[model samples]
Target: MVDKDATAAVSRSEEGDFVKSTWEVTVTSPEGVRHFPVYRTILKVPPVVLRLVQGELHFESALEVLHRREPVASGVLAVGETLRCGDWELSLHDRSGKSRAVLECFTDPFYSRIWTLHEQVTRVGRPGKRENELEIDHPTMSREHAVLSWEERGPVLRSSGRTWVDGVAAAETVLADGALVQMGDLLFQFRLLSELVLARGGLCVTSLGSFQARVHGELVTEKAWRTQAVRWMLARLALEWGRPVAVERLLDEFWPEMPEDKSRNNFNYTISTLRQVLGGSEAILRATGSLQLSPSFLGSHDLVALQRTLRVEDWGAAVELYGEYLPGCYLDWAVAMRGSLEQQVLQGGLRLLERYEASECWPEVLELGGKLHAIDSTCQRTALGVLRAHLGRGNASEGVRFYERFREHLGVELAMEPSAELAALAEQARGG
Candidate 1:
């Protein structure tokens, strides 16, 4: 009864117990606004399925669900260069090409990827589309066998298909290729390997509690606060909302009555908590200001969308959407996603520089420059700050030269950490 013309079937027993991954990215290029479908393939020769225990997309890099590094291949990546990956494509490049922002994959694509959850760069698909991305775990070896009622389980790439994580059934639908999943409308599909499955698993399967504690950790250390009030607020937010929120916005929303000056200091205390958790070294917080959101923190998403919009502030919808109203712009969410100075530098510098360039007032440059410099000294522009640190003492010329280099790459200098060769060239440019 063998149907001829079909290739020799490899039985499930033959395919080896493992998984294969494919990345279906919808990129919004700087030039074109449409979300183009770009794909990357992730495959490892057999035995272990890409058992994503957990996965998250952070400012610096992508951390997997499992502790292992899964195989990944993408032209849009490089070492040390970190860019946000999700519903929209985002990346940074050195204008001067001195060195590109890193596209680092900590676990060599050759090894097994670990698991952890993070923001999904790619959005979920609409109903009725072939799985745009899927990892075939427990791959069937028998080529002849049809996928007989496969069990969808566990966490997958934010948008990957037919997965099983801790026996949870999580899935998204595509309209021939769409990303619209309505929980209320879903037909009890949550029987297994779904959101319900995860929720039900609770403390045992989900890391919500630990992640909250981590959020507080990020706040304290980075901001270096001197109080417990912010932590208390954070706990309340996590309890009320399902996630941690930005501290700044939290203050603005909840502490609306607090004086502005004190609010700033207290907000700082909140960020301080985050720092204590993540440590000050990892470049995890670059995008915190935007990552941390609350009822008032919607701006993070809006700000990002603005980056894609052709005409900013054009319509009533845009006005209402981008935090034009005060009540919707909370900052605690940023506190929740605390990361490193490198991350802050990338996020803040890009944002401020964009605002500064588009702005009518050049006077604000001083303030903007100060804030940018604080995150990544290179943004200090023409300030002597980076030079003092670079040369181990104050040196005006060195600082000037440093700025020249910084501007060449970042469009606006923060503070320079140029290599010896680049510094020499910078000095020459300054002299000229």
Candidate 2:
């Protein structure tokens, strides 16, 4: 039998905590206002509205806009409360009845970590030479957590009228199809294999070689542009993370010889073309801008930034920002990081590897394992790698040490491995 003791009405307001929009709060039940909930979002970039109940708050299902194979549901929301869902925290105020939420997006700490503000907007992609409205106040910036930026209050990001992070518009962004892709921390190339490469193309592939051949041909067939600009664009694509570009760089380096004037516009055209070419690729994020590819993009600066963040006890941000890169990169720095960062880095790095091995981050495995050996000589990379040549399988205790240098090092590995594994490996590595 349905009880007459409960009543719930939903209300929404664009104004956050500024004005409490009270709908008819009719207490018809003998229990008096037994149930009441409110929900809604003022922004439209990623259509989201949440449902709030009298006692508990949860993401209102009707507020979702992005359609995925598996839809991601927003988290629970309560009056004057914060809840983490994916990268954001949903909030509502009871007294003020304010309705607004924020996505606490995570990012790996960089050289300018003290400038959390810079890091926040760094992901927004660079601005053009012309005026950009993206610049805004960062009410979201939290100093206690060492957040850099203010709160990113910009028309470009659109917190009020519109926002991009929560919408299909962000997903609909037309990337160069073949340009490298970066979603959060995972960086890899996107290829057009069979047909599935482009949503419009409808192709998929099993063999990588065929896809590479097809995509490259289509991309290279650029018809209209000054040869220099086209060549420069290719240089940026061909070169990533300071990866080798002898193949294309050579062509671009000698482009002056390629009959020019067939194109119109000089400096302005080149600049505009460059902007269009790079698009949302975040090429400016490179360590620095140079005419040619800077060699420093090579290895593990992301690790450096992360290692420091862990030292400072910024675990939440560390995990959220560079969760994917942590396994391999953390091991190397964990040993060397000291003070608050060491313990935090060691634990978090191991936690990730314990869950994922196919992520196959070997540099850290080698570095941390080596550190262990230097301390006790009984440690092996058994947990991380195949114990194939487990020569140290028996006498783990007394072997000669191998690792020598690190960016920093307080001690070696055996001392660092977690208790259970340390004992087991020691018992086996030594004759215990």
Best candidate (score: TM-score)? 2
lDDT of 2 at 270: 55
Mark the regions of model 1 whose C-alpha exceeds 4 Å error after superposition.
1-336, 340-370, 378-418
Range of the 10 consecutive residues with the lowest summed lDDT in candidate 1 = 196-205
Tens digits of lDDT, candidate 1, 1-432: 111112122212211111111221222445443211111112111111111111211221222121123333222333223333233243322222111011111112211222211222222223233341112122321112111122244222232334322224434321111111111111111111111111111111011112123332222342443344544444334332223245456667656788989887766666565444334412122123422212111111223232222122222222222222112223463334333213533453445445544553344544444444544554333243233333333344755655665656554443335556546644644554
> Candidate 2 residues 1-432, lDDT tens each?
101111133332221111122211111233322112221111111123333333343343323322222345465433444333344333444423221212222122221111111122323322334332222223332112111132434212212222222212233232232333333331223222112112221111111011110121233224433454454343333223233233333333434355444222343355455444444223323211233222212112333444444543443334433422212222222223322343454455445433333454444444444433332233234332322123234323332121112201213533343345433543454453
**lDDT per model vs. reference:** 0.30, 0.30
**Compared to the true structure, candidate 2 yields what TM-score?**
0.23
Model 2 residue 214 CA deviation in Å: 15
